[model samples]
Target: MVQADERPASDTDLITLGRRIRHARTARGLTLDQLGERVGSAPSLLSLVENGRREPRLSLLRAIAEAVGVPLNDLLSTEPPSRRAALEIALDRAQRGPLFAALGLPALKPSQKLPIPVLEQLVGMHQELARREEEAIATPEEARRANTELRLERQARDNYFPQFETIAEDLVTRAGHTGGALTHRTVARIAEQLGFTLLHVEDLPRSARTVTDLRNGRIYLPPASTPGGHGLRSLALQAIAHRVLGHERPRSYGEFLRQRVEITYFAAACLVPRTQAVAFLEASKRERDLAVEDFRDAFGVTHEAAAMRLTNLATVHLGIPLHFLRVGDDGALFRGYANDGVPLPQDVTGAIEGQLVCRRWGAREAFARRDKASEYYQYTDTPAGTFWCSTQTGSGDAGAFSITVGVPYAHAKWFRGRDTPVRRASTCPDPSCCSRPSPDAAERWAASAWPSGRMHQQVLAALPRGAFPGVDDAEVYAFLDKHAPEQ
Candidate 1:
């Protein structure tokens, strides 16, 4: 396995790299001063780095790499002098183009920051080559021609897309919007929905600077931060917007480039809502019951959001029983719970199979039969045999009941269909083997653990609904107290 730190860096032609960085910086409308703030260097030093006049120290190079958003290898060449020298002249000349300079202030070499349309044409060439490769087995001549063309296109795109991120942002900001909502999941969904590919580069080797010449269907983003707080994301976003979105002509790249512009802070808030929920939870502790509807009203969120909030609330505060309460005559376990102070296993979300088994045995029966020596026990025989293993925690006022339960459900859904085999399905049929041993075993696992909404409603509907009224904490504690394990 290639450990990340040992991975070799980019070996792009250095002169080409200089031109690429200079062109990208200018296109983003950032002055030396503005860019300086991001990369943490004086404008003159930045100017020298862009012009290839100064050999940037490793520290400075890493910063510039992050600010320009190209990988370190993209900026500094590791290729042998013979190969690198041959490419440098063309790269340097290409960087001198007025089109590259027009995007911003000119640095020494400027021609290489070519138009996005040019890059797109190159991608079309690659696609054609790939298709042809399948038809004719490559002769020596054909293979050489194909390899040269692909390398040229890859280098061009690698140098330009970092600038595209900037252009995309400008267009979006101009249209009175921001990037998509910012949660791990929502950001992913939005990127896919917009036909944008997401790649994480924070784990790449030698900290190569990232580039995203979108015209070439390439995006480069750093895996982690460099000195001066510069990261691949900022650079990649800048490159994505400026290089990809700035075209005057109509193009397919713009569709992707424009999609990124639609991302907005408001949309992001809907996904995370951290600030809004934290405040509301802090205030709700004063209330006695902490009803879901009441939390919804207080937080100005939907009832479901309120339920989510309750689970989150426990992450911040301890000693609260604020469960996203779902009840039916069948049984009541936490659908969503926040214990506030409990330490628990991270993989508790899909522990319902175990709970169903315990419920089948009847809480009363499990408590009566609880024995430390008991290894295997039956919970139910009808419908399908249900099995359970039981465990308890603490004693006296601190005693807790834990029963691992399992019952047969439609295995097809678990496997996504009957045709496919189930993978890594949980094996917690034995009560003793169920429930990870952790203090927050209940709460940590409960957060986002339940399949609620429609599936939960179905589970509720299957039960005798009206048989159980909304029970109080005291009643709940009283019922459990009877079942509590003896000292």
Candidate 2:
């Protein structure tokens, strides 16, 4: 019986072996006919094997090895016999690749007359084309899966990252920040310390929130007075954090999501330093008055940012497990994170974004309130457990949204809204739980109501294709070229 080593190797390995056999045959001063005659094979068959067009049987390989005066193991070696052989094998494999076949171009034959430079250039171009093809293949479903996986990973760590905290602390300290609002001046200092100059541009790319010119050591951002909800200090810090964290162009959607999480975490840490935020939260907990509004006011950041920052530090430092959610007015989830046992709605892909929130939850309930000026608080009882949440409503270019921070019932004593009487019961993941209409309502309107649905264009479209998805590469390049200073 044939041994495991006698089994045919993979196609790639066979290609390398074929090149080695050809090199050995020529070194032994034998033609294909002479070698094949010794191995009891036809010259045409030997030629096919030598050119990587066919695979030889193990017995035939052993016979050829003996005829060529080389060890059997030498014929099985993975490396090409020489640099020229390596280039030739690469060209052959590239031509066989799916990307090349998709182009419908005829394959080029590598010959002794082909110069090394031409082979190198051809191989390099094929490699680049393969990379671009890979980037173009990212789909919306792939992006959703990546987002789901990243959310689960962050949830495992209680949504906190100490490494980013340490980096932010060091940068803030060097910038001479002594707590309080973390003013724009201090953020600028941090950027300058990292060898970057912040430039407010009127013509920044529409798709980009901020752009970094690595060659010119510049960061371009929208003007401070611009109505976009993103804070100038936060945007600038996020851009600089990318450089500080040594981030590179993401090769996959998963890497891109991870890098975005890291940079945003770094910026949040800088905006609300861990040392200060932790101390404040600890004090609030001691007073049994932990409130997101106070946290937002103290840090001079937005309500959503403050609530998200709570998710980053509450469980890790304050010993309080909780959940955070950002829900749109239409009751669809935009973002969600939980270390507490509360169950959030998710689709088949395990993605929570764009999934409908239970109508009974605090996130959706807050949208019904007439008083948009004040925070809404509620207690929700779910299958997992009871949670008390505080939600704040805000509007942006996209529309209205509610940001909610919730803790399990047992941990509610440390928060301010624990005494509120508003409460709800939910049985989500069940079809009857806020998803189906009541018997009377369904009988009245289900048959007669024919509503037009607003289709989400992004859902039907493929994910943006490029190293940085959704960014217009041509516009960015043109902007840079126009603004680049003379050398």
Candidate 3:
């Protein structure tokens, strides 16, 4: 019988063996399906063995050798398992020191030898980590954190391996079984399904051919075009490989699995493009007012995706400072900040008195539109800023909502201490509000909410109907100027 480790003599030998298997099946006058049934496997599996899609398992080879009326040793004479090939590749990497150096990792000197046990230990540790990663499966909080980390790592590596563009294009071609060169129609179908377009793809120049280990997959592209070609390639490989190696595990370990997945390369590449998404965002004047829909149209992303991307954008990238706040009828406080990471003040001490913030803002605007006498009341009062522009949707009074970009005060304090006074009003405005301390104390604690952030803001500008306006540039500069770190 063939042993698992013995290598087949040559490609010719493997092909001859495949041919023998085919001849035996044919001689029996049994269809491939019938032969597959005898082996307790799929026809495709048997066919792949004959066509070399995979190396034949020793057990299968033994059975096939018997079925073919051949001596077991004849079938056993094949080469060692595929793992040997993988080992050889790993050794070659160890030899050049380029593998480590390319990844901006310390290179192992040629004179040094890695202890076999130590290497095994590292692999074992990876397996253990994989297990730990899977244990917390099904928790929404964990899933979200995993997704966020995957998005960040993938975005970073794709910036390095632009050649993976070719890999993606090739994958599309290989996906079809017909084995023809990829045609425009096929490419278009794949692109449309994936929601992306490959632009400015070109072949690597022959002079610069270099193979980079994208930790998960190998990328063969021209080298020396940029600093640390090998390093970038290795980083990209690792990012992708981490995802691939762990994908089979459950959601608890999804981050571990996804890290080995090669898809990270594509995601990262999409983000840090040759031109960058921020350039388009700036060109569109989005900093003035970050409307999720407007940004979505420009990037071809969903509204949520656009908003998240905006949160990641740096002022340096867009040449304009950006700030984001989450506001509701309750009031506005800092939810998050990007680029410079300005912390929203948690201690808001003051309250807006006698303000019909959410309810009367729109009515005041409509009334102002009809007559000059009512123009003074047109501005809606809120904690963030004057209501400049908005777009509303949903039905029933509570469903309608709007987002307004407000100018924050130079030293605005958004959060006040627990001891800070809350206005006298209902126990809890909405019974469904989970933030309420106790269900029993709901209605009695509801706040007579006013605009939360900069309560003093007066409406100097307003968006026309149907527009979701953003904070103005002058207002942003003023806010930043006031809050700028004192020299």
How large is the C-alpha RMSD of every model relative to the true structure? 28.9, 10.2, 24.5
Q: How close is every model to the real structure, measured as TM-score?
A: 0.20, 0.75, 0.27
Model 3: per-residue Cα lDDT at residue 315: 38
Compute the lDDT for candidate 2: 0.90
What's the number of clashes in each of the models?
A: 56, 0, 53
lDDT of 3 by residue, 79-188 (tens): 32233222332343343443234346454421125555554554454445445433544343343454445534543432134454445434454445132222334433
1-487: candidate 1 lDDT, tens digit per residue: 7555444333344454555566556656677898889978898877776655555556666676677666766556533223333344444444465433444854442234644455445445444544533333323333334333432342233212323334333433443333322223333333343445546544322313333333324444554434322123334343333333342322222222233332221221233244444455556544323334454455343344344434433333423332222222233343322222111122233222213323333332334444743322232233222222112211223243332222133211211122322122223344443335455776677675776542443333221111121213344344334433464
Q: In model 3, where do residues sit more than 4 Å from their true spots?
A: 1-136, 144-276, 285-293, 314-316, 319-487
Best by TM-score: 2
Candidate 3, overall lDDT?
Answer: 0.39
Q: Over the stretch 237-355, how does candidate 2's per-residue lDDT look in tens digits?
A: 98998899999888777788788999999999999999999999999999999999999999888999999999999998989999999999999999999989889899877899899
User: What local distance difference test score does each model get?
Assistant: 0.38, 0.90, 0.39
TM-score of model 2 relative to the true fold? Answer: 0.75
Cα miss at 213, model 1 (Å)?
Answer: 15
1 or 2: which has the higher TM-score? 2
Question: Any idea how many clashes model 2 has?
Answer: 0
